[model samples]
Target: MAVDLEPLDQALETAHLPALSAALVHLTGETSWLRPEWRPTYTPLSRGETGVPEAEQAKMRAAAKAAITAYLTGKAPMAAIPSPEVLHQMMNFVAGADIPEGYGDFLTDELAIDGHSTKDPNWSTPELKAAARKLNVLVVGAGMSGLLAAIRLTQAGVPFEIVDKNPDVGGTWLENTYPGCRVDSSNHIYSYSFEPNHFWPQHFSTQPVLLDYFRGVAGRYDLKKKVRFETVVEEMAWDEARSVWKVRLKTPSGIEHVEANAVITAVGQLNRPRFPDIKGRESFRGPSFHSAEWRHDVDLTGKRVAVIGTGASAFQFVPEIVGKVASLSVFQRTPPWGFPVPHYHEDVPEGMNWLMEHVPFYDKWYRFWMFWMVTDGLLPMVTADPDWTGPTTAVSQLNLGFREMIAAAIAAQAPDRPDLVAKIIPTYPPGGKRALLDNGVWLDALKRDNVELVTDAISEVTASGIVTADGQARDFDVIIYGTGFHASKFLWPMKIKGRQGADLHETWAGDPRAYLGMTTPGFPNLFMIYGPNTNIVVNGSIVFFSECSVRYILGCLKLLAQTGAAAMEPKREVHDAFNIRVDEGNRLMAWGAPQVTSWYKNEAGRVTQNWPFALVDYWRATLAPDPKDFILTKSAELVE
Candidate 1:
């Protein structure tokens, strides 16, 4: 409510008026405010098609600009909440889904906006802060989720420490330095809901920009002071008797132990890189490294390179390195399905950037646009139709149409290169694997004379080169493992001992499961962010999910503080029931498609990585932790 007029004037001066007007219209829900001529001509344009011509857009922009200037000069406080009808209309416009029963909650809880009470409970309250201060919370990994947890905890006046294995923040962005390593998700929505950056250079921003953004977030919140860099959590034992967690930390100096009341494991699934167990991999004389551990020093100019595994990372880096290498051999175990994205590599236009920074609610509305675009967009395609017969092409009619669109895109991109087309089109369902974004660069790279897409199974990696199953040995100067990470392995390497000294790894037995992907039955006062079955492969941003998880964890802590409880864990029956429902839901998803093999699944063929439900479903589940679903032990009982 206390906005400076100067900032508003700067925004209004060069603001994209059409976009600004639309944002205000969406936010205020005042139809009269936007003239008929200034309104958007197209509601939902198909992919690759431009909507609303430049001439019409210019006119709208001019009108909207004038209107914003008038409103700013009048010095009106922006309405904090819209009418119920306006809210409903906004929901319909943004989500493109039927207004659900708890649509208002979805706006506040999921969106984390000003309309509702999404803020953390008053931990700053003297008694609450005193109780929380007495407790020690250890967060593992100073990544996106961990940083968020720290920020929330700091705001809540909770005492916590962060131990990250990496030297700095930005876990994935810090590690993955592979060429063309950029996010497939839209940059606008990929970030934290509360921390929107309106001036991203690229729509799908590269790793460096992302890393910088994270560092900025960490710096802004003063989170770096609380973090112990170059430290790893080796083991964590929940001392149920003492109602505390004894965490064994591995640091550069020596091993250390920290006793904490609770632990929030923000160590994400994609942190650990998984390399193929190829025979004679060690015998290779050439410099070989996983894409995550990219060797930037090694120059590939005029050198032959072999890129193994055509997954997301490989798909990105291969295109970038193809031109540099004299001959590039891409070994594909399974081809990835590329989603059509015309603006994947395009820069965020200056006009749009101005609109985002200057225009009132424009950034928020833009984020809403992005959120709605991905939410439930591909659910139908990924949801398997048992009655439908065609397995090779797609899962259903809609999915088939999607498949046709992309496949045709590939063909159109490389009409002369049929061999590349055959090798490129994935045999599995579209959403079975993480869908990649393509703007013709990947297909164009494959059509180059120096590039070869090898669909052969790698037999062995000889000192000279790699040998295929067909007994053909191809020589290369360098080998790059574009293979992904150990995603199914949740909280890996850390020997977590729960109640009765139950090893966390042994308990799961390679198939990790968590109740609502946050709490386990035995791990008292322990929470997980971006844990098992919480990975967003298709719909929504992982950052959004992390926010949800952190809030849920905070809610649990709030419950403990309010009840004077020492510790709390999910009830066994409750945890079991939640997982059972998760399993049932996953059975209907594309990841559960019998023939598909992806990182999403564990060794047991169970979907241990993905959230089968929509983002709203998860939002509702994490709104608060029910006391009935948890076994709460009072502080008095613990003392006794």
Candidate 2:
């Protein structure tokens, strides 16, 4: 019932220094760094510290290999270890950060490391079986969060239906197939905790592999059976009289209506591509498209390409197309902070693969190592230091350190051209916007004779190409916009009505706020995954946030089933109070810096699309549903 230890074992045998050091700490609850005799040949600051004396390196490698071999050969059952000890290990792995009180519950519920053995507390009780049977849940979107919801519902024996506009289950990944499209998050830890893939060919997997992975997950969980592919939820109304959700769906054949006791909206933020509102956009006679809706059939060979918005997507695809295209112009509003990752495009080594296949618990331990490093390691840097005076550079001293590191990386890219560095280096805080991972590919592409970095504002688009504010009109055969998404607009273009005919859109007026990023007042029996204020900016993977949100939704469903409640909604006061806390927390985060302007905020300057707290804080808040924070209406049968 526990997470298989095979992956972790394999990681240990591979002796990947960081993974091994983290695992040793986690497994033994050790606060100190690995002993020199057992340390791997690498450290964070210095790569390939294999410069260690031959005898010493051999001794350490042999000792580490032997230690992992013992676990793989059944001498050690790591899963059999107690939970408290594991918690200790987790804390030590996170540099001795105090474990939150709700962490144990978070581990079992959100992490679900026991490979689906742990059921929602409400469904686990026999008394709720009848009520649970009556539950008909509708999950909108068959993407990552939607798949998780469907799997959990099936495990809880609840009848549910998933509707996705996409023909397949990959959602964003399925739609985005631009050249060089890939995941920014580490593939190993970016996946479902229970279903780890040790065979990721690259540390940062490409779009196709990610799509296949999601499709594979859907198949493994038997979720496709419950999914109505190419179906979109047009509108959903809360039928207060019936205490159910009346969902209007648009399928391939025709529109259909269904009634569900509960609804889970898993439509995430990244799907909607936001095209810049530029003059003469319609005048562009060339084959113009958003990067997400790439036209692969159109050949770019010897063609002049005009790419707009140098964001994450632009950073990726520019390097790929620079060599193939004849002339390339990259338009930028603001340059992003680039974090240098030397092996960003490197394939996974064979030795690492061998350890993953052969060593026990190795993959699991390595995934945990990644989780801790990315999740908590970057959090402190993003938090605002009230007394710190630096504004244009960074929000805090820790953030200044990050800024310096990224600046050095930019300098390394174009060492001779201080002009290029000045244009490329961001003036805002490091985590104010997304910090892109680079290995000089971006700068190298910009340095190409065929490539030009255009920082001027777009004056207008001509029939053949773009006209910049510098009054120069450059002609191109193609235009690609990498301007990201309408992230702050949550549940956009969907008409959702709740109690008293309260419209979801009108309620927020373009600023969406949900209680714990799951439920909103007046919307009974409705839950959201990847909702407002839940996006991670500085720390953790979006997948992790989705899991946390799903767990919270499951907890709500449990409460409704166990209590035989006709409806349950967050109290208005509670919802408002939670949002107030979110705003305050965001004020103390770099993303909320006054000079910073990004998609994370709404028109009113409210930070609507990010989680400002540490991952553990979110986990703690969503461990269980607080009955007092909700208004529950008992069912007629239960009342009788």
Candidate 3:
């Protein structure tokens, strides 16, 4: 059943309305705007029709008026809202509505006035030159992050060069060109907030569209010129004698040395693919490839295919290839929680786009609604409930409810396959790991006669087939590994050196940690973007976190220019204290729970990946750099 106005009304009735009204007024400091819609009464309405009634409009208006009056007259209740369901449903309605054309243009104009635009008065060419003279910045991996750094540095008048091993600029978008590959995040939120794309063809953009967006961003900002594509930085050492980074870089042609005052490592975690080390992986004779490196030349029609690992990439690609392949063998590791997402494939109506584009305050409110729904509203569900008895595997009561909903969906799709249901049901909490969206297609694909779901461990890869631990052999013409990435490893294969020539990998010891996921103590003037513990587990855009990191990095550069500082790094004590706080915060979250074994935590049982706070909290913390947290050195001073 589709979600409609009835659920909202029932939710409101179940919730304490008077308390919610009082809380809304107190939160917004506006009593009149906190009123309910007059046309929609408190009664539940039917689906697939307009629920508002003219007859009850006056009564609803009176109720809202009374609430507003009571609140304004200082008679507001001190009690908090019993539940947020009503507000959550209201936000869903707001988001489901139309977005107007030219919405991006309007936001751009406003941002221009606020000095946040790329063409703002504060971003003059002279400022860029001044920053260049004072600070030498090194940008790692010339993908989205590197390009963005170059643009910001150029705008701020700072001199910087982008280094990347690949010959192209698109990071994951460039590498992962598999069939049916696309972005799961909405295109509106995926693109940079400062550089919004008005011409996205799909609401959920494809890989090519995203690649084009990155290319366009680079060209528009003149960042391509500063990027040294194919040049890889082998090692970066903090030179105490000169108070500069000694960068050893390798190009296809030869090696080169450069000195930089600051470094920004934006290589990101998902760049490397992690393949499972099966006993006889090397013996596969037909064809084997990771989902990231999909081979298009090998057609799937009438061909037997063995797909290993059921993760996010597999979820997207499996449905796409299920119909084409003759027989399919799916290897199961752990089942992911699937949430019903109605608009996962629905197009944005022209009227909705119009409202988003032309209607003042509409787009902002819509974005705010999304932010609340994904992050603030969903974050609470990530905690473990000590009193819940429904399932020990599920994190909380709310999460258990979610698991039931998903189970119902799976059952509806695969009525004949109770065995498959048992295999696919997750024993862990709903939000313990990444939650995938269901369009009702995956289960249908699995129910196909040609499909096989194998739960046994892969024992070996024979010359002609794969043998499971059960001693059963399955012949396949192709093998696809959707085994995911080495997420907790942070920076792998890349050797980074800091003070005393300490190797970064050796220091991390397989589990990476960073102060605020941006800096390490010994790595003076070096910053890591999208570093460990910076990943948002709840609802929020990764782009939002990236922007916050960018702001902090910019602030550091500004300080260097203002003080002629030779080097700056977070103080050892401050770094340790911040890590302690992060660990303490994680202890209360689901990732830190003893039984959970998600990639969010490392082998040492440390929650090294996810951020344990709300998006707003991180934003407030990183809005500006705190000089007190860093060890700053003047250009004239020499270190002992």
Which candidate's TM-score is highest? 1
Among all windows of 10 consecutive residues in model 3, the one with the lowest summed lDDT is 39-48
What value of lDDT does candidate 3 attain over all alpha carbons?
A: 0.70
Cα lDDT computed for each candidate against the true fold: 0.79, 0.78, 0.70
**Best candidate, lDDT-wise?**
1
Can you give the TM-score per candidate against the true fold? Answer: 0.93, 0.91, 0.82
Regarding TM-score, does 2 or 3 come out ahead? 2
Which sequence of candidate numbers ranks them by lDDT, best first? Answer: 1, 2, 3
- Model 2, 1-640: lDDT tens digits are 2334445434433455545554444343343434444333333322234344657645645556555555556566453433655554453443323545545555544444443323343465566666677899999998889998888888777899988998889888889888888887789778887677878899789999998999999998878888898888889998877998998988899999999999999999878899999999989887999998999988989999999999999999999999889999999899998777777788887567766665444566566556655666568877889888865679998889878877887797788888888999999998898878887899999988888888989989989899999899899999999999988878877899998899999999989999989999989988999999989875367888877777778888888877778888898899998899999999888889888899999998889988888787887787678889889887534322
Cα deviation of 549, candidate 3, in Å: 0.4
Prediction-by-prediction clash tally:
2, 18, 18
Report the C-alpha displacement of residue 403, candidate 1, in angstroms: 1.1
Put down candidate 3 lDDT per residue, 225-294, tens digits, no spaces. 8878889888778888788888889998899999888889998878788898888888889989999888
Work out candidate 3's RMSD over C-alphas: 9.0
- lDDT by residue (1-640, candidate 1, tens digit) is 4334444444544443433554666444465444544433322213312244667656655556555565556654455556556655555544434556566667655454554446455576788878777778999989999999999898787899999999999889888888999987888889987788989998889999999999999999999999999998899998877889999999999999999999999888888888899999999999999999999899999999999988888878888988888999999888888877777888876656766765567777667656655755557667878787875557777778877777887788877878778888988887888888888888888888998889989999999899999999999899999888888879998999988899988999998988999889778888999988998767468888898888889989888887888888888899889999998888787777888888888888999988888787888888888888888886425311
What does candidate 1 score on TM? 0.93
